[model samples]
Target: MGTTPLTPGLAPSPGSDGTGVVEMYAGDRASQALGIVVEDFGEDWARCSMTVGPDMANGHGITHGGYLFLFADTTFAMACNTEGSVTVASGGDITFLRPSHVGDALTAEGRAVATTGRSGVYDITVRRGDEVIAVYRGRSRTLPARPAPPAAG
Candidate 1:
């Protein structure tokens, strides 16, 4: 953490339209706390954006790798969970191509590469406008649907 927290004005917060995305983001304190917004999404893809805050900067004065990974991962989560099943990352990897700074608006877009037998592979690209900042590839596992609780009388 650097100089700022999730203050006001990081408007149009995550997922205000899609039901699954909305629900997922609604319970996602991490993404919300970072002020990520869901720009658009479809069956196997999602696009999100966030502006880097001072709190996300690293000792080198650029945005931290963890924050970049988190942004990409959040977009991946949105893409993989659009089918209405709870999915979680089994593992993921990211490569930083360029550095982003505080106040830099970044966009993370993810798309499913493959899926089979409850496992999925997704690739996420993080960009500062037209510049590619990072690329993330994630493996996910979709959990079995939980049984509903007992109905009330």
Candidate 2:
């Protein structure tokens, strides 16, 4: 599959909208191949969903492990990149519980687990229907706050 471009926190610069640019990257395309779509974006959370298909399958005809990781990663990025404090993933760990297969509609959800100064932690969960397929924990560091944009001349 393709990779989805996770939005990187923008630097503090004049005229910056505060919220960094949001774009779909290679990993997103991979998620799209699995039929994934970001359904919601919020202050401290993000939700993504995808329908499993043959294109998402590995040699064994099940959803590939990478796909699951991407799903959690994307959600983690979204949750960490909050307003005021820019977030970057410093580390993460994921655990797979069961195999997800074709025809399963999987949803990845992420939430803030903890925060300390410029660093924050997020938890991500991947589920098919009501079954939890994977769980992930991500650590992120927020850069120093940027100054607001200067007024135009």
Candidate 3:
């Protein structure tokens, strides 16, 4: 498929919220079901986070791989679509770096690395504190921009 390029100094800051893009992504029921919050949303990048609780743990009490994947994927979705159009990931792969534990707040950030025509590549990183727990590369397809509706009569 496609590949994601890396952005220099790409990272997420804390305490920022309510951005229209973030709201479009994380304010949905899917994000709420996963306990995720979008902390930052920018034209070229996006970030989301969630608390690793008991409910997210595997039999060994460690955060499950699926949770990490979803977090990274969600961030990927937001970053790719931050330009105010619908974006969908067509393919993705994630690498686990370290295990996450209960009570650890996990954050995932994504940056658009490259785009060709209607396809885009995104790089996603999942972190706990300063430690990276996972890294992902995803490809997205951007839908055609929609036109504004006619004014009311």
- TM-scores of the candidates are 0.85, 0.71, 0.78
Task: Give the range where candidate 3 is weakest over 10 consecutive residues by summed lDDT.
Answer: 1-10
Q: Tell me the tens digit of each residue's lDDT in model 2 across 1-153.
A: 342333234232343232532543233454555555665556667777766767668998888988788878877876666353557789999999999998888888888878878878899999988899999999988777789899999
Point out where model 2 deviates above 4 Å: 1-35, 145-153
The models' CA-based lDDT, in order, is 0.84, 0.71, 0.76
Task: Name the TM-score of candidate 1.
Answer: 0.85
Clashing pairs in 2: 2-26, 3-26, 3-27, 3-28, 4-26, 4-27, 4-28, 5-25, 15-149
**Model 2 — which ten-residue stretch has the worst lDDT?**
9-18
Better of 1 and 3 by TM-score: 1
lDDT of 1 by residue, 26-127 (tens): 788888788887777777788888999999999999999999999999999988877667889999999999999999999988988999999999999999
Candidate 3 residue 61 Cα shift, in angstroms, is 1.7
Sequence-dependent TM-score of model 3: 0.78
Highest TM-score against the true fold, candidate: 1
Query: Sort by TM-score, best first: what order?
Result: 1, 3, 2
Report the number of the highest-lDDT candidate. 1
Q: Candidate 3, residues 23-92: lDDT per residue as tens digits?
A: 4643466666767776666675787778886888999888899888888888888787665567788999
lDDT at 35, model 3: 72
